[model samples]
Target: MLPRSWVAGARRPGPTPPAARRSRLYAHLFLWVMQSWLAMFYIGAGYAKLTQKHDLLALMMTWPAQVDTELLRVIGGIETALALFIVAPLMSWSLFRSVMLVGAAGLLADAGGMVVFHTLNGDIFLAAVNCVLLLMSLIILLGRWEWRDHAQLRNATS
Candidate 1:
């Protein structure tokens, strides 16, 4: 059997106790905050791309040049869609957990790519920003995965 400290830290893979539940609640709360932050951030980014304003001009003017207008809009649309994905889980939509997972995964990929892109463009600061975002997305992904695993374990036992 596990040691007491180990057991307490491990918790079981079944129904959550009060302390476990509290931790889960905190995780959910963090998820909500992340979801909100990512949704707003992406939505605004996508909006800027769609409208060809703000960062659009910068995108056109800067390192990765000659990005087509329509392309920008399409990228924005995808970003906005991902933002909606994050929001759905918050609203407790039936398929939202999966959707949020997918969104987080997508953002994780995006951030990782941006990190490389920025580094290649000699924009160390931008690369660092994306690296931070990548780590943040990763934290959300892992936390959500833990929660998902517990939920599935609970269901299977039930």
Candidate 2:
């Protein structure tokens, strides 16, 4: 047997008490808001990549002649697809995880490429931004389990 205070602290509440329930509701709402923000960011990024015809491609073409246009196009297409996958409502948790993993990898690669470009061309600001975005993507990918739980809770509430 334990002391009365210890027992009281250890006791498990049935389901959730009213106050606890309200807190959980608020937490769920916050999670939904975060999810919406993430989804919208991905959607906007994909849109920008798809719509903008930037000089990045031209710059790439000038590099090591072995780099092909087809490869660049394929990378752009993959990024857009992954962004769409992140925002898709019907995607499974496993699929979302896979997409996040791939996106993180891509972001890391982009960061490396940006660093190299900046080192060669002396563009510190762009390289720093790319590094920051890479870190954000890695953090999101690592915390995917929490996002999965949030998604599950949201689905249950709906």
Pick the TM-score winner.
Answer: 1
RMSD of 2: 8.6
Write one digit per residue (lDDT tens) for candidate 1, span 1-158.
86666554445566668998898799888877877887788888777777766454675547325456666677788888877876777568566888888988988888898898889888898899778778877877787775667898999899
Off by over 4 Å in 1: 1-16, 53-56, 59-66, 146-158
Model 1: how large is the Cα RMSD against the reference?
A: 7.1
lDDT of 2 by residue, 1-158 (tens): 87766664456546767898898688656544544454455455545445544556455334323345555455556656655554443366555656655655565565567567755766677668656655655554554446677787999899
lDDT of 2 at 148: 71
Q: How close is candidate 1 to the true structure, as a TM-score?
A: 0.74
What TM-score against the true fold does each predicted structure earn?
0.74, 0.48
Please report how far candidate 2 places residue 27 from its true position, in Å: 8.6
In model 1, the clashing pairs are: none
RMSD values, in order shown = 7.1, 8.6
CA deviation > 4 Å runs, candidate 2? 1-72, 88-90, 145-158
Score candidate 2 by lDDT.
Answer: 0.57
